[model samples]
Every structure is written in structure tokens, then in C-alpha cells.
Target: MVGTSEDLHRLFSFYWFLEAESRNTRSREWAEYFTLIRTQIDLFTMDKFDEELVTQSREAARSKPLKFWSRYRISGGALA
Candidate 1:
């Protein structure tokens, strides 16, 4: 599945809450069960694209004249 890392983290957080609530019960045996499910799930994020494109854009901006750098804005890890 594809989603932002924040969403994925939130999903795991919910699982943790469920585990915590069931602590001391037979259900506790399923603690972190999502971890096992995650092992079989393929997840993808735009982190690599942002790291490569945005980082390079920022570096290139640093080398440009101040006027050029100021002409464009970097928003959401993208050149805008």
C-alpha cells in the first residue's frame, strides 16, 4: 500500500494502543501483530524522490544568485 509515513506511523500507534489495552489478557499475545502483518506488506513513500529532487534543488539554489533563489519558493519539499 502507498501512504505518507505519518499515516503509517499513526496506524501502528493505534495497534500499540490496542495492545496496551489488552495487556494481561489472552489478546496480549497479539501485541504488535501489525509488525508481523507489515512484514508481508509492501509500502512505498516519496521520501527518496524528495531527498533527491528537493535536496538537489536546494543545493542548486544555494549556488545561484540571491535574486534567482528568491524568485522561486520551495514548498512541500518541492520547487514551486
Candidate 2:
């Protein structure tokens, strides 16, 4: 399992669509999503993606409740 509320599995919670995409086990979709994250992450550069990275991103997001923009990293970090 990913984790509980305390842990909150930020990767899954924040990247809920990714979790769904993974659960569906669609490699093409995951690849597209992975590519999106790699090419478009604004704050930091990432060569690879994993649960830890996802969680860290989510945590960073939580620190600022007032931020208006959506940080959802979709295909090539495109706006959805």
C-alpha cells in the first residue's frame, strides 16, 4: 500500500491521476506522465521519478496554501 492519512501518501494524493494511471498499468500513459514531469518541473531538475520525488513535491506544495496556480504535472507539464 502507499500509506495512511498521517503519511497521507502524498504521491498518490497529490498525483491522484498518476496513481490511477499506474493502477491501470498503462505503460504508455505512465511514460507520457513521466516525460511530462522530467521536462516541465519548474523548481528543480529531476532525471528520474519515484515515490519519494512525488511526496517531496507534494510537501513543497502544501507549504503555500495561497498559491493560486495548479502544480499538476501532466504530460510535459502541460496545462489541463
Candidate 3:
């Protein structure tokens, strides 16, 4: 379990670096991908931890509402 956690952590680190470095171009995709991977890491890391940690995690998530641009939306003009 420790090794698996470490590997996931490394993947999260790599994706985070990619997101930070490519903030100007294709950042949303990278950011969303990072978020997905981060979720896995957070779940694994906190699975055996205390309830306070879980509560803190939920609080942190609640504090950050997705931005306008970050909201997933399809782009297309209406037919005339």
C-alpha cells in the first residue's frame, strides 16, 4: 500500500508540474486531469487517517468553487 501510494503521489506531482508549466495553453485539460488524479491520491492518502483530516478535506473542497471558465460547457452557436 505504501508503494502504491508513493507511485500515485509521483503521478500527481508530474501532472501538477504539467499544469503549472502549461498554464497559458491547454491548461484546463491539464487542470482537470490533475484534479482527477489528485482525487485518487487524496482518497488513498486519507483512507486510513482520522476523521478530522476527512473533514478538513471536505472543507477545503467547499471553499474552492469552480471558476466560470473552468466550468465544463459545450461551445456552439445556435442555428438560425
Candidate 4:
């Protein structure tokens, strides 16, 4: 979930932890995938993303090369 820049950053931070904890190539791959998505999030936010950007962001992530986290999606909330 992501309501603001901080929220998105938190999600990315979790992904960072996942990347660090990964033990296999697949897990690591997913980590890099999420990292890219996170980078997009950061850029999208910096660009002042509104509803339109939100849609674009999701779509962009959907098109990523790796789809390990296809089931996961960013929404209007925070990780915790």
C-alpha cells in the first residue's frame, strides 16, 4: 500500500530487507524486481503523481521483466 512518499519508501525498505535475506537466485531476482518498482515509485512520487500517475505506476510495474510478485500490488495504505 502507498498513500504518500513515506509509505512507498517503507514498502521499498521491506523489499530491501527481502533482497538482503534472499538465499537463492530466484528470491534475489524478485528483490531486484521490486527494487526497480520501488525506484519507479520514487520517481513517480517526485514527479507529483496523482491518480493518473498511480495508474501508470501500476501499469509500469506490471510490465516489468520479472513477474515474481505479480500477485502483489500497491494500494492506498502502508505496510505498517
Q: Highest TM-score: which candidate? A: 3
TM-score of each: 0.30, 0.24, 0.34, 0.32
Candidate 4 pairs with clashing backbones: none
Give me the runs in candidate 3 sitting further than 4 Å from their true place. Answer: 2-27, 48-80
What global local distance difference test value does model 4 have? Answer: 0.48
Among these predictions, the greatest lDDT belongs to 4
- lDDT of every model, 2 decimals: 0.38, 0.44, 0.45, 0.48
Query: Could you give the C-alpha RMSD of every candidate to the true structure, in order shown?
Result: 16.5, 10.7, 11.8, 12.1
Summarize candidate 1's per-residue lDDT along 24-72 as a digit string, tens digits: 3344345446344433322222243344443344334334423422333
Q: Model 4, range 1-80, lDDT digits (tens) per residue? A: 33763444444444444443343335556667766766775575656656664555444443441333433333312332
Distance from true location, Cα of 20 in model 1, Å: 0.4
Q: Lowest summed-lDDT stretch of 10 residues in model 2?
A: 64-73
Residue 12 of candidate 2: its Cα lDDT? Answer: 30
| Two-way TM-score contest, 1 vs 2, winner | 1
TM-score of predicted model 4? 0.32
Model 4, position 21: C-alpha lDDT score: 35
Worst 10 residues of 1 by lDDT: 40-49
Error of 2 at 54 (Å): 18
